[model samples]
Target: ADMPGISKDRLNVKVEGDTLTIEGDAEIPMPEGMEPLYADVRATHYQRSFTLSSEMDTEKVEASLKHGVLTLHIPKREEHKPRKIEVQVD
Candidate 1:
């Protein structure tokens, strides 16, 4: 996710059952000792939700935010992973 201007401290990520939620607050700070006469950008709240599949391992999900980009790594369950079987010569 491209979340420019949002700090990591103001971001929240949570997973409940099959639901995954992401919330954050975006605020434009004013320069010190300067008052804004008119501001085009203002503070805003952002939220997004997603439903995870059973094949995904929720417990092993990983999240990281850097350079205003949020990244999520969701790995497949053990049973869902591809397996190789070798056949024995009868």
Candidate 2:
């Protein structure tokens, strides 16, 4: 996710059952001793939810945030991974 201007500490990721939820707050702070008289940008709250497939392993999900970008890695279940099949010729 391209979440520019959002701090990692202000982000939250959670998975429950088949639902995945992401929540965060975005705020722009003003300089010390400076007050905003006519500001166009305001604080914002963001939340997104997704339904995970049965083949996805929620227990092994990994999340990382760097340079204002959020990344999620979800591996498929062991049984759902592709396997090579051997052919026997008689």
Evaluated with lDDT, which candidate comes out highest?
A: 1
TM-score of each: 0.85, 0.85
Model 2 ranges off by over 4 Å: 36-43
Q: What TM-score quantifies how close candidate 2 is to the native fold? A: 0.85
lDDT, model 2: 0.88
Q: Which ten residues in a row have the lowest lDDT in candidate 1?
A: 36-45
Clashes of each: 0, 0
Clash pairs detected, candidate 2: none
Q: Tell how far residue 18 is off in model 1, in angstroms.
A: 0.2
Which consecutive 10 residues in model 2 have the weakest lDDT in total? 38-47
Clashing pairs in 1: none
Those runs of model 1 whose alpha carbons end farther than 4 Å from true positions after fitting are: 32-43
Task: Give one digit per residue, the lDDT tens place, for model 1 in 4-89.
Answer: 77898999999999999999988678779998888655547889999999999999989999988999999999999999999999
